[model samples]
Target: MGPKGPKVIHVGYTPAHVEQVFFPHAEVVGDLGLSLARLARAG
Candidate 1:
């Protein structure tokens, strides 16, 4: 969706909330990142 590939976005949640829904890759970004990922974006 951007200049690279599909755009990845975060719906605005606390780091804890994001973690509870998804895995963490950067304490917070990990969840948002993986949510939009097509591969192993969490690792």
Candidate 2:
């Protein structure tokens, strides 16, 4: 478990793989952006 909750399993893939898998979803843009923003804030 992570700080907030249970962590997601990435399953046999890297960043590029997951990005490609979610490419067709419109929410991907905002989701990825939020993820990057969170990382930036954490750093």
Candidate 3:
């Protein structure tokens, strides 16, 4: 976790694998570009 809390977006085929390796509360997505774009727009 960072100063502002968890800010990681793990993009992968297996969400379980990401949770095990990276962050358990990470925002797992199938499409990296689309997800990032959406976040960018929202922010």
What stretches of model 1 exceed 4 Å from their correct place?
1-30, 39-43
- Clashing residue pairs in all predictions, respectively, total 3, 0, 0
Question: Residue 42: error of model 2 in Å?
Answer: 0.1
> Would you list the rank order by lDDT, best first?
3, 1, 2
RMSD of each: 11.3, 9.9, 4.1
Candidates in descending TM-score order? 3, 2, 1
Q: Which ten residues in a row have the lowest lDDT in candidate 2?
A: 20-29
Clashing pairs in 3: none
Q: Looking at candidate 3, what is the lDDT of residue 8?
A: 68
How well does each candidate superpose onto the true structure, as a TM-score?
0.19, 0.31, 0.44
Compose the digit string of candidate 2's lDDT tens values, residues 9-33: 3322234244523332212223656
Each model's lDDT: 0.43, 0.42, 0.61
Please tell me which predicted candidate would have the highest TM-score against the true structure: 3
Better of 2 and 3 by TM-score: 3
lDDT of 1 at 13: 35
| Poorest 10 consecutive residues by lDDT, candidate 3 | 12-21
Candidate no. 1 TM-score: 0.19
